[model samples]
Target: MTSQTTEATPDGGQLRVSTLELFFDLVFVFTITQLTHVFVHHPGWDAVAQIALMFGVIWWMYSGYAWLTNEVAPTSSGRRGLLTLGMFGFFVLALAIPDAFHGSGVAFGLGFVLVTCVHTALFASSGGSSAITAIKHIAPFNVLSAGLVLVGGFLHGWPQYLCWALALACQIGSPYLIDTSGFEVRPRHFAERHGLVIIVAIGESIVSIGVGLTGRDLTVGLVANVAVGLALAYVLWWAYFGIDDERGEHALSAVPPRERSRPALFAYGYSLYPMLIGVTLAAAGIQMSIAHGNERASLAAATALSAGVALYFVGQWAFRLTLRLPRPWTRLVAAAVVCLTIPIGVAWVAWAQLALLVAIAYAAVIIDDVITLRTGHHSSYV
Candidate 1:
């Protein structure tokens, strides 16, 4: 069955998201590459501060545009045009990020601040007081970051580093300034949007695995490694989209706008942390495997994949609890995710054994779900 609802806005009510909105997701393909590059290059303690700060800023900008699109789009062409421009800004920003904290800090910071201007235009064109509020909250940080970028232009060494650090702080804190109270989110629409992005992340993982395996000797070990990587991706999808998503939609839909926003932020925005982190880790693992399975699996790769699997279950449990869903089957899914991590852990003893074990464990989860449905035990949790 299909479901639809009209969101009542200060502006005329309109359909939530349309073909254009879905198509805009292509912009993030560039974004995903930028983020993946950051982790790949540095993947260390020093990088963590910058990575976390940058990730949050990227989410804030993307979510801000998305929220505006949910409200102002279809009703206004100007809004759509501004969003298209904003996507361009994002493209520029992605290109400039590699040198943002270093010598090219000016170009990187300017690219990002320009994005803020696009966001400001988008929200202002939407014609609500919150537009002004969002602008006020975000612009200072943008300006501040811009100033640091200017200073870093001439400075070197620690002087440049200090400015970037200050800029990072401002970027990370911008969302809280905008505040989530009273922002409207149509639940199914929001869930579906983020769900599509998750699929993109997973699809990228598959592509990364394929890229890793290509033009190499087709050995049994390489074949098995591919199978295991694909299995892990499937399990991650099943755990989130399969069960938790519907529950989250129902829960968010039931709440008053004020009460609903935090969970929405946590469930949707924060959930990407695990999903993207997992994809990055999986990519690293594939790279390691392709390098002739020579070195021991790094702690970082294992942690990334494991954390991704663990977060899916955590997200599931959180989804159920938020909605007061008490289904036994949901609990079983959570248990199965915990068990799935064991194979990833087994990599320490033997990498090939780890791959095979991961496949079995993931298959076990799918088989259990199938059996549950077969016996008439499948129950709606929301």
Candidate 2:
């Protein structure tokens, strides 16, 4: 199950992302877009939970394939074909997101099962007996989780949600429940894959602004709001990429082989979930505010915008912690500022409040940059 073959050599030759991998990532762009639509149309606690649950399922399944590719290069014709099939599976899953909690649940469930089964088969077909043994430990939970998802498709109300939640739990918890010590992750590939997905999530936010303005005639006010939304998105991007993009990969590469899986799971697998969630919520908020421009913002819309910013900071804190890097004090303070401003900004127009939120984020980035300069700790990655 352990893969000495996947580790980097002493010279630190970085593994490049392959063409097939980029093609595969296109499907996730649509998946994240669809998830944002779920929140755009349905704005309530129930919808939030459903979106979060479904997002977790999609993220988990996608990350599994990412880890698989880290070990097995997708250069062969057969491997490319398998990955192409996975793309179709994910496309169907994305299409079914609108009705995942309703009539098309069966489609979503079947899609989930299809993708998971393909991944398991790929691992089973790997070269080593250890790979096969790893499959033995991993496949049963996948099968059971798939079954639960399928069964959940047939139910309704909270009963259906309960079933889906349990399925997600089983799928997410399985790696920890079983011994995956024999498994290996290529640090660069793993980090790059996750980072690419984060970019996809941010792209979804930008798409939301367009979708929100679908048929409306562009006005000065609307154009101004769109510009502000773009600024917020840019700040989020800088917040992540401005720091060492490869810090996590470098940190993971430094870990002793036997101990890498835990940090990989906790940091990339778990901590990144909230980051994705934050982007989705922000998309929802941006869409809502744009659609309601020049009007009083609802509590829900304000909360989504503020909470989304806070969650991003919180997620960044966890991710930086995992890399054993310095704490992101600016992000933490920014998150607190957003939360505290929410109640007081309730009376402000939605667009104005959004502008203020952007200001807060920019301030944090400026402060962090100043601190890095003072300490001479600033660094960049290509």
Candidate 3:
């Protein structure tokens, strides 16, 4: 499974992500927007289930591209073209997301099939012998997953959920089906690229706040809501970028290239879905709360505001575990405490619950920082 191609990056030092890949992320931005919309429309346990199911499939492919590009850089015109084709498929998938479980399942299925095809074709055609061999072992599972999604499009209710769940299972289990010891990870590029995607995905939170401002007069309550929402967003950003982002890169770089896939899988590939889903839910909740600043939040809005932050902490904890980082007990405690405030959002003013979420998040960060400093856990120099 190891790539014998021995390709060097353009800089011959670090293989930085290319402009075309950044351009491809515009499609990713749209995908996140569509996902957020799904949550905003149906803010509850059902939204959680739908987002987990749909995004599980979507993020799997997105992660596949991240790994694909990590190995097969889009340095040539042909590679760039294939990457663009994949972007188109992603756009189609996003377009279908709003109604995917209703009348648009087939559209999403078609897009999923196209994305799978392009990923398989690009990996087989452009990758090194190691990559080709890896794809050979991996592509059937991908095609079968795509077929399951297409089949799910024609089914309904529990059957549809079952089929799509199987598709997602197929993806999540792909790495273990064969030895990923043959896979390659350009550590810096892989880490930085996934970091870029998460940053942009979370940026949607700020956008959601602005969207909340539409058609409303400038008022102090609205101002406070926006400020607290932004503070929560900053808290989330600092939680990742402040320490864990660099730690993730360090963990990957510290490992042997062949063994890098394990941390990369658990840390980046698996953990990203919950983190991004939290962003989507939090963003929608912010929009709703800010839009109705004077009223008590709905059950859905309250859950999104509280559970979204909880999920982020949980996801970050999982990520730290995979990287074998220091204790994240504060994250779990913070998550539990935040969930207690959902009833507050349901009964009190939205801004009160919103501010409480920010407070809990900041406290978690400070506590984690103090514990890290006291325990002399300063390992990663980044």
In order of appearance, the predictions have TM-scores of 0.76, 0.92, 0.94
Q: Each candidate's lDDT (Cα)?
A: 0.59, 0.79, 0.83
Q: Identify the runs in model 3 with alpha carbons over 4 angstroms from their true place.
A: 1-14, 374-382
**Ranking by lDDT, best first?**
3, 2, 1
Model 3 C-alpha lDDT versus the unseen true structure? 0.83
State the lDDT of candidate 1 residue by residue for 284-351, as single tens digits. 44443443443455555444445445544554555555455545355446545554544544454335
lDDT of 3 at 13: 23
Which pairs of residues clash in candidate 1, taking residues 3 or more apart in a chain or in different chains? Answer: none
User: Clash totals for all models, in order?
Assistant: 0, 3, 2
- Model 1 misplaced regions, further than 4 Å: 1-16, 41-43, 47-49, 74-76, 129-179, 290-295, 311-382
241-340, model 3: which lDDT tens digit per residue? 8778877788789998778888888899888778888888888888888878678999899888788888888888888888888776667788899898
Which segments of candidate 2 are over 4 A away from where they belong? Answer: 1-14, 127-129, 328-330
Candidate 1 CA-lDDT value: 0.59
Candidate number of the best lDDT: 3
Candidate closer to the true structure by TM-score (higher is better), 2 or 3? 3
Ranking by TM-score: 3, 2, 1
